[model samples]
Structures are given as C-alpha cells and as structure tokens.
Target chain A: MEKTWNNKAWFMVLPVLVLVAFSAVIPLMTVVNYSVQDTFGNNEFFWAGTDWFLDVLESDRFWDALTRNLIFSAIILAIEIPLGIVIALNMPKKGIGVPICLVLMALPLLIPWNVVGTIWQVFGRVDIGLLGRTLATLGINYNYVQNPLDAWVTLIIMDVWHWTSLVVLLCYAGLVSIPDAYYQAAKIDGASRWSVFRYIQLPKMKRVLLIAFLLRFMDSFMIYTEPFVVTGGGPGNSTTFLSIDLVKMAIGQFDLGPAAALSIIYFLIILLLSWIFYTVMTTSDAQG
Target chain B: MDFSWMAWTLPTALFFLAIALMLVGMGVWEYVSPGGNPRVGVLRFETTRGDRLFVSLLGSAFIHLAWLGLVGANLWWALALSAIYAIGVFRYV
Candidate 1:
C-alpha cells in the first residue's frame, strides 16, 4: 500500500512544539546566556568568554559531584532493573489480582520528588518515624542527619521505593504485549519457566527495558529534590548528586556564571549518555 | 478580639468562584468535544495512565495548597494525601 504524506500533521504538532520551546528551550537559552557572561547584582551581564566554563572544568567540586552522580545512577540501575524484573515476574499475569497488584506497584511513582524525600525524612526519624524509631530501639543508631552512610542508604532506599514501580510497569507492559501463541509454542516444546522467561519474555521486553534503563539512568543522575528535601545535601555532601550541587551553587551561593557553566556541562553529559544509551540499545536490537 | 465576618465571607466566596470557573471551563470543553477530551494529548505523554493521572495531580496540587493553608506545611501528611489521591485516581479514573 502506498502511503500519502500529509504536511498538515506538522501543524498538529505546533502547540506542543511551542509549549516545549517556551518551557525547555527558553530556559536553556537563558542558561547558555548566563554561562557565557558575568552578572552582577543589578541584573547586568558582562561578556566573559570561556572564563566560567574554564573555571567549572578546573573545579574539583564539579568533578566530585559528577563522579557522585555517575556512581548513584549506576547503583540505582544495578538495584532497580533486576529487582523490578523479578517483581514483575512474580506478579500475576491474569486474574482479579492483576489490577490490584498493578495499582499497588504504581503507588510510589505518584508521590512528588520533594515529598518522597519528606516521607523518608520523617520515616527515618528516630522519634516518630517508623524505620528510625525501630532501628533506634534495636540499638542500630541510625540518623540520616548526622551520618554519611545512613544518609546515602536512606536516599537510595527512598529512590528505589519511588522509582522501581516505573521499571516494573515498563517491564509489565512488555510482558503483557507478548502473544499467547509464543507462550503456547514454548509450552508445547516443554520449555521450563526459566527457559520461557529467557527465550520468550526477555526478548519481547528488550525495547521497553532499554527505555526503562535510560529513564532511570537520566533521572537518577539528575536526582535533586528528594535528597535535597531529605538531607538538604548535608552529612558532609554524601548525597550531593550533580543536580543538588548545581542548585546549591546557583540558588544557594548565587554563583551564576560558574553555576551556569556547570549546568550546561551537566545537561550535555545527560544528553551524551542518553544518546549513547539509545545508540547501543538500537544497535543491539538491530543485531538481535 | 471580635473578627469581622465580611473578611472571611468575601475571600471564601471568591475562592469558590475561582474553582467554579475551572469547573465551568471543563464542562464547556466536555460539551464542545464530547468524543475526544481536548486536554487528552497533555495527559497521554510522559506517563502511561495518561491525562486522567495528570488531572488528578493537578487536583492534588490544590489539595496540597489547602493543606499548607490549613495545616502549617506538614510535608509528610501532604505527601501521603497526594499519594493516596494518585492511587485513587489510578483505580477509579
């Protein structure tokens, strides 16, 4: 069948394009403007060509935050991806329980980022917080505000609790989309549960899993609000991902030039990593 | 100190009027395009459950504001309430 191309479809996309340009592109341009210029308190900008960028590149703080972000993203991907798949596998494929299970899994992803932090903050409190009080009662001495390890653990747990559902949902979508004929063929061939998952389910889930990985990686690398809300990036900067550090530099210290440069660099890193992820996943899909 | 009734009554009435405006706007939209919701596109992208979830999030933002006004910025309570609202939306909406 020959397909007719309709140019008017572009008009349909115009509203979203306008919205995105305003919300995303304009802010980005402003950031770029700030990055390339020096600003004083009176909202006056002076041209400072490459000076702030050079300073940011040379700064140890930027490097440390970048490393922390990379490590956190890696840790989250490692934990959540496998755990999500396992949870999805365990969930009932068909029954009255399916919607119930799905709803329960989706509960965490609904909470706002700051609120996720707050929930963990109170939950980890030694007084009225459940986890903290229980730990203290058992002589575990857990305090996120005072201890770096505790803060890191609390942040990771909070993120996993909140985001693992996303992974599960993606994986579930993949699993459910597989044809019944494929399962029937696998069953007729006397395939085991492990074999069925590996040969049939995993392959079907590859695309959504790639998407899940990318989304999780990008979000985890840019994690700010939850950690900021929970620990305020304290306990000796243990939970200070790049986003938190950027906000701290820009909003807290009001170092516009350096912060702008850092922000651009951070944005570029995310863009680059996402591009790389997309390339690798697509290439693998083509090969497979 | 005797509080003035007009101060409370006027603000409350105006607040409700603003809410009524949003409801009327939604009703007009539903009336105009009954088959396809005008705001469906905004809801469909980003998340799977679509625009209903987004609408629920919008509603919860109002709830959060009300909580802040009434309960002195209890973050955990607000968070929990919002989460419950989202969950309710997932099932019912």
Candidate 2:
C-alpha cells in the first residue's frame, strides 16, 4: 500500500488542538506563572524566581507526603496484581456465568470516587459500621481515626476492593483472547496445570498486565478522594499523599507559589516514573 | 487577547520562548531528515533523536530543580550544568 500526503488532514485535528490549548495548556501556563511569582494579596505580585521550588523540595512536609504516596502505591500494586490474576484465571470462560462475573467485577469501578469514599467512611465506623463493629466485638482495637496502622489498613483494603476489579477485567480479557489451540496442545503434551498457566497464559496476558500495573500505579499514587473522605488525612498527617498535601497548600492555606511549584514537581515525577516504567517494560518485552 | 491575567513576566516569557524554539527546531530537523534513526544508547534502550531531545529536556529540568534545592538562588551554575547535561544526552543518550 502507498500513502498520499494531504495537508488538509490537519484541519481535522484543529478542534482537538484548540480544545487542548484551552483546557490543558492554558491552565499549565498559569501554574508555571504562579510558580515563579509571589503575591501578598489582591493582584499585587513580586518575582520570587525559583524560591518556591526550592522551598517545596527542601520541606519535610512535602517529602513526607511523597513518601506516603510511594508506600501506598507500592502496597496497592503488591496486593492487587496477583489477586486480579487469580480471580481472572477462575472466571468462567463461557455461558451465562461470564456476564454475571463481568458485571460483578465492574460494579465497584462504576461507582463515583467520592461516593465510594463516603461508603467506606461510614462502613468503617465503630459505632454503626459493620467491619468496625465486628472488630470491636472481637476485642480488637480497630479505629482508623486514631491508629495510623488501622488507617493505612482501611485505606489499603478500601482501595483493593475498589480497584482490583479493573486489573481482573484486563487480565480476563487477555485470558479469553487466547485461542483454544494453545490449551489443547498443552494438554496433549501432558503438561500440568501450573505449566499450562506459566507457559501459555502468562505470556499472553503480559501486555494487559503491564497496562493494569501502570494504571493502578498512577491512580494509587494520585489517590486523594477516598483517603480524604475516610480519614481526612489523619489524627495527624499520616495519610497525606501528594495531592492532599497540594490541596492543603493551595486551597487551605492559600500558598499559591509553593503549591504551584509542588504541582510542577509532582507532575514531572509522575511523567518521569511512567516513562521509565514504559521503557523498561517494553525493552524487556522486546528481549523476551 | 487579554493576557495580563496570567501575570506573565520577562524571564518567564523568555523561558517559554526558549522551549517553543527548541520544539520548532526539532520539528524542522525532523522535516529535513525524515526518520530520526533510532539507536540503542548507554541506557540499554532504543531512542530516536526526538526521544533523546525529550530526555535531555526532562533531565535538565530535574538538574535545575535539584540545583535550586541544594544550592542557592544563583542559577547560573545550574544553567551551565543543564547545558552540559543536554549536550551529553544529545551525544550519548
């Protein structure tokens, strides 16, 4: 096949360019502007240079929030990936059970983020909530409000319940797409179940697994709403991830300069990490 | 267009302009040479010229930020370091 160059094709992309310029570029420019400037109040501004960026990078508060974010993301990925694969492997391949399982897996994902947070917030109350009350009855001191460990556990469990379905759905899609021929050949060779999975299934699911991993990593890193609604970032600053910290700086304390600087640094960190993940995964995939 | 609301200043404007020029220069280079001729670099992955340029720019941003954090507000040294980094990325990365 041959291709023809058509300059008119750019016209089709004009709308999207315009939209992005307004939506993403404009706001980003404003953030950059705010990042380098300081204001006392009421439109009076002074050129502060890179002071805010320096301040953010030097601050213990910013580092603590970042560490919390990294730990939370790491824990989420550790729990969700294997659990999702297991669930996907057990899912029915054919018949009415397939749709039922799919719908069940998708239900949590369909719920709005804030609503999910609210549900978990109420669901973990010692006074009336199910899990909290049960723990109390069992002579366990389970209070997410007071105990940092309990808060972390509740957040992790809440996240697993909410997001593990996405990974399962992705892996299931990968599983179902495998031709029956591979399974048949494995059976003919007298391969055990583990070998069949290890050799055939895992390889096919690699691409989807990568997608699920990256999606979960990014989402968990940027997690704010659920933790915010549930614990309100504390008895202290225990659950304050980067986004929560940014919001507190920007809106709560109205520290625009530092907040803007933090925003740029945060965005850059995600971009750099994601790029590394994509490069490393694809490179290994090519070699393997 | 009423652009005053954004509170743009001279240094910031120059910074953005430099970025825009770099992008335009890259686009022109691509137009002149076509395929960027990707090569495996010291990092053990394949990268095209544009990819190298991106890597350089991103690395420079971090270098500048790190310098700002570790050192003082005098950014001339940071700028020099970033320039050297960009050169290194172009040459080897």
Question: lDDT score, residue A242, model 1?
Answer: 83
The DockQ-based CAPRI class assigned to model 2 is: medium
**Alpha-carbon local distance difference test for all models:** 0.79, 0.92
Interface RMSD of each: 21.3, 1.2
Query: A59-94, model 1: which lDDT tens digit per residue?
Result: 788788899888889989999999999998888999
Give the number of the best model, judged by TM-score. 2
What are the TM values for chain B, all candidates?
A: 0.46, 0.95
Residue B22 lDDT (model 1) = 57
Q: Please, what are the lDDT tens digits per residue for candidate 2 over residues B1-93?
A: 878778788888898899999989988898899889688889988999999988988898898888888787888998999999889988887
Cα deviation of A284 in candidate 2 (Å)? 0.9
**Model 2 per-residue lDDT at A123:** 88
Candidate 1 colliding pairs: B43-B51
Model 2, which residues run further than 4 Å from truth? none
